[model samples]
Target: MAEEKQTCYEGSSVQSFQFYLEHSGEHKAILQCVHNLLPGEFKRVAEGKSSLDVLGVGSGGGEVDAQMLTLLQSTVPAVPITADIVEGSSALTDNFKALVAKTTNLQKIPFAWHIMHSEDYEKHVKAKGVKKFDFIHMIQMIYYVDDLAESIKFHHSLLKKNGRLMIIIETAHGGWDTLWKTYKKDLCVHAITEYRSSAEVISCLKSQGLKYEEHVITNAFDISECFNPSSQTGQRLLNFMTAKDNFYQSFTSETRAGILDLLKNKCSTQRDGGVFFNSNLSCILVHA
Candidate 1:
């Protein structure tokens, strides 16, 4: 019998993630990386073209989408842009809609929301005869997909000739990987997989028979600002690190205490006050 497929985002993880996003300063970091990845000029380039259709795959909370919308509105005012947000979580979709309502720039653009899994969205696009999008983006969410190559192909199919498919991934290179490797035994359980390198992303895109351009954009966060035990940010981080009950149980009280202490000390120190983490965003600007 075939093994059942594992769901990427669980309820507990989603709740924890929402909390973490609010406090961890990752939102800012992500926004910065994305800004550097796709400068305002790209929007102008797309606008100079004939047709404009943009799709954001796995658009969680619509934070990045909101930014993209703002860029498009400013750079390509003449182009009537249609953005389709493909997200599976209803809660996330709801939050995205609320954000859209609040943001003036995002509200001005014509947009659609599809509450469907990435795979299902691909199928729907194929069946509905929607073949090409001017631009397609997957930001920090591709790691969750079961089959990376297949997923890339699906998104590639949605691109028009010479259209660009951009992917922004958080590089698992610096302190982020160091911390995870050090605490993996005590902090990680369930043997989840993470794509940790740019080469892997490049290889996957190549296997899909797509040619692309790549750029590495790096940004850092000061963990000191959010690592206090008594602070809301610190608590959120704790909760995020301990999402699964069984996973939490794997660590001895002493080990848990030690990790917390380490985090606290690291956050408090002036020399390393900034929990410096960098993301090398491998953007594959593909042509169809």
Candidate 2:
């Protein structure tokens, strides 16, 4: 068996991760994209099913998962739902469960938690001979998979007839795309780069002749804190984005300054008198 690789999100301190989200504005951007995509407007092809089976890959804290499920319920009010969540973090899994317990709308919805990475989820489900799902969602988490083609194939295979697989990833020219690509080539050999951008994923889908639709969501994060070299919060943001501990201190001063300058000039834009790291989020819906 191959050794499991540790992800930046899984290895970092929870507080640092939370702080990165807050400072980077990814939390709201993610929710906004989910809200835009999960409306009752989806074609009711799976209309008459008695129960809906939803698989949430890398569901994180479950806040977004619950929101999506609530929207799904509105579309098909009478169908019972079974949400099977897969996340690698125990803390995030617990947080998701707590969210389910407290939210009235989610309280009535059935849920199962799988505290494992996406690949592990596949292995466990295959061993148990689990059936397919009516809906499977992978939101902003595909960048961590080692093989994007294999992962997409597996996720698509797990969808029942007329089932939908929804994926959210950054655009080809987005800040994250540039930063991750640079870091992958220069620093981290094990870094995940397959399907890192919407363009890449779309290319894969086109080559495979998969029927899919893509939507774009515009979002930005405040990178003003990163202007100060001595700022602790700024360092944390850098560390999280690069998936490196002590990013500023890890590299030579010249290299560190060059990277920081690149981030400031190339990765960010000055908007409304604020330094915003512009992001282009692509929502790809694939029908089986």
Candidate 3:
């Protein structure tokens, strides 16, 4: 809104995301879900294959992608694996490349990194038109796509027989979701923004008569700093949460107070001397 002096996808947005991740701490439960689910899916996809083709969309910094790929390699150790990762931020792409350079464990897995958004990656692959993958994952990435339905279909089409497409997204009932939904019209004015949850994805799959399984990853984080109106760290967390500039100052005093009250009473809980919000996330396994 207000022409967005700085949007969430360019410039320093990479630092914004890093700050959010650092403040949110480790999402162990989400990682655990991936660890538990990917092995079985890898076995299913690699059943009759000697090699694996995987795609990662919006694979920021390649942290989760590395984890999932490592698990897949362990599950089907004999199968050679190739991965094509798409990311929009060059800063993040550089970080991923640096991580890849130092991580000896991932050396055996050949990676093709495309430092671009999901829509461009779609256009890139359409030129070849003959490529398909045993596994395709869009981790915390569905929000940044230009066309939600077409993007989902495009990825689904890339799945080989019995292959799995995994999507990780925020749950509809989290503090982030609560904030986004309330301010959705403003935040989603950007071409790269759309706030959708696993439920929406599941509904889309069901509407298309596709098969899918859903797993909810329940987690929480201490957001006590957000209550402090003067804390810069708090501001960074709030900026990432809202993906908006001048969040508190932009709102009317009455509106900001209401928002703070709603955040505490409806979206989070008080525990262990910290204000924690249920940053619940979910993963949907769409099968081909």
Q: lDDT: which candidate is best?
A: 3
TM-score for each of the candidates:
0.76, 0.91, 0.92
lDDT measured at residue 192 in model 1 versus the true structure, 0 to 100: 38
Q: lDDT tens digits, residues 1-288, model 1?
A: 534334344566677777666654766766775666565535534845755788999887788788877776666676677889988777788889999888877766777888777777777777787746877888777766767878887788777755778887655454444444557665444423543445667888777667887765555444553445466565556655444433235567787776656554432233543553342345556667
RMSD of each predicted structure: 4.5, 2.2, 3.3
- Please list all clashing residue pairs in model 1, or write none if there are none: 223-275
Scored by lDDT, model 3 comes in at 0.79
Q: Could you tell me which 10 consecutive residues in candidate 3 have the lowest summed lDDT?
A: 1-10
Clashes (backbone N, CA, C under 3 Å), per candidate, total 1, 0, 0
lDDT of 3 by residue, 51-117 (tens): 8899888788888877888898889889899988888777788888888888887888888888777
Candidate 1: list runs displaced more than 4 Å. Answer: 1-12, 36-48, 178-196, 224-232, 241-282
Q: What's the best-to-worst order under lDDT?
A: 3, 2, 1
Deviating ranges (above 4 Å) for candidate 3:
1-8
State the RMSD for candidate 2.
2.2
lDDT of 2 by residue, 71-114 (tens): 88777777788888988788888888998888898988878788
Q: Give the TM-score of candidate 2.
A: 0.91
In model 1, where is the ten-residue run with the lowest total lDDT?
264-273
